[model samples]
Target: RVLVAEPRRIAARAAARRMAWLLGERPGGKVGFTVRGERQAGRGTVVEVVTTGVLLQRLQRDQELAGVDVVVLDECHERHLDADTAAAFLLDVRATLRPDLRLIAASATTDAEGWARLLGDGGTDGGGVEDGRADGTGGGADGSGSERWDGRPGKPAPVVSAPGVSHPVEVVWAPPERPVRPPHGMRVDPALLDHVAAVVRRALREREGDVLCFLPGVGEIARVAGKLGGLDGAEVLQVHGRAPAAVQEAVLSGADGGRRRVVLATSVAESSLTVPGVRIVVDCGLAREPRMDHARGLSALTTVRASRAAARQRAGRAGREAPGVVYRCWPEAEDARLPRFPSPEIAGADLTAFALQTACWGDPDASGLALLDPPPAGAMTAARETLTAIGAVDTAGRATERGTRMARLGLHPRLARALIDGAKEVGARRAAEVVALLSEEPPREYGDDLAAAWRTARHGGDPYATRWRQEARRLEHALTPETSARRGTARGGDGPGRSENGPGRGGDDPEHSSGDPGRRGDGPGRGSDQRGGGGPSRGEDGPGHGGDPRGGGGPARRGDGPRGDNLPTRGSDLRGGNGPARRGDGPGRGGHDPARGGDGPRGG
Candidate 1:
């Protein structure tokens, strides 16, 4: 039996105890625990073990264990990217390495029954157990070892011919029928922090186990924890990709006597790690993701619809150990808009990891295969180009040895590039720090800085400069102080050349201009032409339009000057300056009286 849990859950002393037991030196023999930092089980004994799911996966890749009676995968519901990959690999392992090994998956909240159906019922074939009861063991009437397979009565290891993987879960709706009123607030009705606090208060009053709250990002989690301030007998813990393992452990297992506890977490908790003893779940119905812009090659983590799978996972927290309650902030109708499945990581995320993984797997093109869903062609192309730029893949479409190493490190391609570059200049220690920061949430200062505005004006561009700044800060804070200092020193010493061939472009005179002629202003009047007296005045129509008619019997020509007929004449002078020049005998030419034959009004 293998109990899979989060990395922080496997404490050193607990691990040692488990190891002692596994070695038959202690009471609970056949039990051990392994993690990234420490691995101590009986030197040779192994029956029941507790391990982080990730470590087990790594071991499977590195070590090939033979002769295993059965592989029991507990807590199969996490659905983490690594977990999914591990499960799939285990299926293959069963086919190749251990054909006789029985695979039993246990999950209190996941659809284990559905999996049972998929694996076919282990029930006897047309042989009723009631008739075979005379044998004292509940075996089939045939009575040929149909029971006692695992030392239990009437329950043998059912031979399961994998009937095509379990049917996809369906969306079930239970309408609240509440009137959809325009929620009165400057922002959304469920101010995430407020919702979490409400859940926390209720959990405390009810003396329920620790409360688990799913928020969108690190900022929200912090904000809510801050709001809770200093509550006695209870500790508030924040969980997300950015938090340290120690902090996460403190939340998973609090102080003695089971004092009330609250955990404000990001989507990482939604499907990856399971927090035991959580009796209440508070869901804010939002998850932050990078809003991607293909054209600009940038993205921002904006709030988006959480998938149905994610929602289910959040709700499952309520019923994990026993029957519990879940408080959804939004109306039922709002939940309906969520996607039926978790957003394919390939589609929404930066493709660096996916591309590198595919390259290492020898499928450089990522062409033909049954991926649950494929990323957009443009995204795929961009990732391939990015990988090529980083020298992870050669021109011949093969992953270089360095690429394999990068994939093993599990980081985004851009960050991987930065790490590689940083390593060459700054050294491995600094490079590792940068990679770690890039993987987690950035710091507070980074989030607040105005200088972190988006470079592009597209949908996925850095529209939310505040969020980017926060992420940058989180990234910065995640690293050790020594590493942070080293990065700063390296950056300062690099001179101007360090940024020469940066992500976009850089030089003494940085230009945002794309340098495309189509983008340049090429119309009739622009720039200095307006001040050069080269274009039409403000209200006046140009060239073929606004002009006097009688002056030239047509529209006024350029450079011909203003028409005189339209000019107002002075009242003092009749035929001299400032007056209308007389034509023939008329003193006032424009007012000439034709009835007097031009002589009366003219008065010569």
Candidate 2:
């Protein structure tokens, strides 16, 4: 029996809600749904839930059959990595292991023709021949109608069905234009700023609905929102991941009585859920992502152009209710350069979780797992090494019992270490403080000086910083003598019974050499601060192979009086060679050859 459900009958929101409810029920011990507040199940037969893009991530970890009957991929044309990966992974699984399973890829303005091809559609089923079929019909291959549905004049094909029909979209051409570019080498383009501001002002003037300006990151959003100042008769709201939930709700809800609203947001607004009544979209065409540089042992952030797919989805935000306008901050020519799909987080993110989960799953060679885009070998190796260094993974590359417990915390391994250390020394107070800070933005008001940074953080009233300090206090209050107070409570106390509690009470400053200015410190050793004429207290800590004078050291010098014996000589001058008309054959001409072992030349 084929089911025909109206698009509005079961919308994405309704479906998500339904799934969330279903997952809330406990099944067997095989499936589960976990959210921030609570985890509904440990193991179950079927699970469904809403998380901030963590579902697709979880699925990526388990590539085999997950016993799912159907995957309703809603809003896929959003071009989110999570949605794209879910669709691709489902297709792969259907083609490989679970051919009986079904995939309902839903999108308001998806590339239907292209997707039909991916679904093995043929020409005979009202789908184009490019749909991986012959004559638009199921070529009578592996026994199912495979293509014909909704009666499009073929062999009664039951392989596919068309939910509804749509009229062709007509394009209205505007004059060609380009956004001004920044000077070479600078990443932030001023032209982008002007373009964004212009679009926003236009939206406020003409559009009655809320305006959403998609910026690259929180920093750019903040800067632009500040420039906009609060718009008259409009609630100017800035939204980002780190903002408080109440602030997010206010921004997302907009002003009273359907008033004009402007939400300055990041890429987090790109998908998953829709903010009501947004009809004007201002796109900056830039997004920030972390890309790994394995050689550097760090992940660097880069801002790059958004994909055409992403741009289209953003534009679709305008047409959700009625036809609206989308302003692109970049020249149309740059659209071609955008990536077709966003990069996977797994490819570039810190892989502490990858290491932990793979260990739990009994896969030692996680790099060898059949990933769509595998992580770099160096990154995987680095993750393993980090795990071992933290004792999460043993010499054999297996997760210890402690590692398992730490994984339950859902924190990065390093943060977990800090938490454990903090708990053991200062009670739970300091550990929670450090954990919260590590999870959110670091202490922002602090300058380059570490001591000053700590001091400023201690006094700053920003919610993020305050929450961290509060957690630190909680950890401190949670301390037990057997676990914490018994430990040393002073700095430079790294030996037995050393306490981990309180900053500046842990160990010696590694950069100092035991308060001895003359003693060389670690690495390229510091110069000794000694009194003048203190028996060469500060020696040049240069390379053992000697060094060039062009460096920091002083040049070699010679004494004024080199010859011990003196004799009266004619045509000799002390000041300049011009006055010194000395001759080689004259008296005192047979001088010692200083270059030849200090021996004077033989007197002829």
Q: Which structure among the candidates has the greatest TM-score?
A: 2
Worst 10 residues of 1 by lDDT: 504-513
Candidate 1: tens digits of C-alpha lDDT, residues 1-604 = 3433331222222444545745657624455544322234443535534332333334333323354454445434322222333333444444455554455544333343233322222343311111111112221122224322122344223322222211122222322234322321111223445655665675577646777877654445555677788787787787543344456566555445667768776554553345767777777665533324455343322345566656776776666466677776666767778775444334553454456655665567666322324557877787677667666788866789766654433234444444444444334553343233222222223321111211111113231233233323423432333543343321111111011001101000000000000000110111111211001111111111122111101222222211123211222121111233222211111111010111111111
Each prediction's Cα RMSD?
25.0, 21.7
- Clash counts per candidate, in order, are 12, 30
lDDT of each: 0.38, 0.40
* TM-score, cand. 2 vs. native: 0.56
Q: Which stretches of candidate 2 lie over 4 Å from their true place?
A: 1-34, 38-48, 52-187, 442-604
